[model samples]
Target: MNYQTISITLLILCLPQSEANDEAIRLGLKQVELSKDLNGWKPVTQSKQIRYGEWTTNAPIGQVGTGGGWGNWGTSVVWEDYKTVTSNEFERASLNNGENGLRIQSIEPFVPSNATKYYQEELGSFIISPRIDLSTTTQDSLFFQYKSNTKMNLEIWISKDQDSYWGIWEENPNRFRNHISATVAENDFTQIKINLHDLLIEMGQIFCDNERHDAVINPETNEVYIAFVAYDNAERRLGSDPKMIEIKSIWTSSYYSDGQLQPAPIDPVISFDHKCSSVTISGRVGETYELQTSSDLDDWKTSYSFTLETYFETYPISDFQNTTMRTMFFRLKHKP
Candidate 1:
């Protein structure tokens, strides 16, 4: 069994780019700021409990609303006053809307534990989600609404293992399968939707070992875990403070509903780069495609099957060649 790997480390730093074309394969990032329709997709149910840590001051357990209904689970760690303690004042506050929604201030700086000794320190906080079922074949999607009075950086992470816990207090927290960054909000509740399969391909394991490995979600065998991490630097005032970024109404769903007419599949654009001796294909993310080889251009054999994590992908032309042939033809085919 040969599993494919997407290596961000080698792709950018180590991989050699050919001058055949001055440009490299690039994919336009999905726009999360725009509002999206549910498209008949149902909301994924969430367990109403915090997997780790206690609620911050003013944020009590079991708050209500779409945001508060899902449960607020968060923790914070700080390098403060020069002396560290178990008690934290800068942890994320959970708000009640029906269920508790996690909140982090972008305007107010955290007071140093020892204000006398040090002027500032560093603070890290995160809100984690309970295990949820997200499948690849069905085009499962994650949706959430967020409101921010100020700009805030948010790192979203996913893991297939249910036991994988991420907390600032943990000695060795588990590494998520993939992660991506996004701005929290633009002063109001903004709806965002991300396809699960697309996310795995878009963000391939960056927090773990340097070696390349497959980041897959096997719904039959595993449940998915997600976490949102935010950082604050008091020394430099590099993070959000007084204004808050609130996340609520988080859910997952299949891209289409039952009997919904599927959209027409788009064909992949294939081209050859003689200088690099490679074949490049540009296609939509999450769509599985195949590269085929033929001796006479009539009987083509499938050589490789892959889903585009990015908008554009390139493969060495030599990999599809079985023998030193005088002539060989190649084509790209969409899979279903």
Candidate 2:
């Protein structure tokens, strides 16, 4: 008697599952906020002059009226043509509260008492990360810790394929923001973990005309960088409490699924129950899975999808028995 084994695979979940004892490589600024220093990380700005100092309302000339101008008030940073600075030649950007991590808070528009047109000033900063190396990873996941005001709209952008600047990317400049805001309480820090492949899939759905796109961390990739831009224009409203955002750390880990490092595949246990004419599959309890079937092993179709309430699931082989087919194969897939 020939018995076929059940196959399993991973599915993306809203919340990531944890695998015990997995180490992560710290990404971006290496605890800069913990040390109370911006380090190599800097806020995006227009003027190269105002690098280090107290956050001010001083807007440089040619940066006031229209083109990149918010009357020199607030942070002189904009989404379009965003640039980053490093090295002593550039001024250092300032954050609030050394004990509370790197906080970039919104400010009231520096409306000069004599100004004619108040071109809605930008209040918050768009901090960019230093060039990150993803070339070493075939697939990876990210873990980060941060907090923000409820009204704050945090946006993220990526630069890949050796882009010259932080805001720039090889293709598709679309922005990506995870649904972490729901879990984050006002002014309270929350930590989140996400698989990069899953994030790329989400980005492709939202940005690429609803088409599936290729993963960004393949072998051909040369350079990659991530920018955490906190510019909630809604937070700029007058008489509203100032909106702020802060970051403590960012790190990446090798790909894993269902609390286990993956590609070290964990196969399911299968046994035939001839007395009942059924097949039993034993796997980690309380996990969701998709059951698929194939006739020629080339074309597969989903037969059943469900979550396990127990350590084992049993099904009548008659459910999948085909009269005309001599051979049939079944596989079970699990999503983390």
Number of the top lDDT candidate = 2
For candidate 2, lDDT tens digit of each residue in 273-333? 5544556665555567777778989998877767754344555656666777678787877
RMSD per model, one decimal: 23.2, 21.9
* lDDT to native, each model: 0.45, 0.46
Question: Which segments of candidate 1 are over 4 A away from where they belong?
Answer: 1-100, 105-120, 149-152, 162-187, 202-211, 214-221, 234-241, 253-336
Model 2 TM-score (2 dp): 0.39
TM-score of each: 0.36, 0.39
Candidate 2 — which residues are off by over 4 angstroms?
A: 1-36, 46-100, 109-124, 161-187, 201-222, 232-241, 252-336
Instruction: Judging by TM-score against the true structure, name the best candidate.
Output: 2
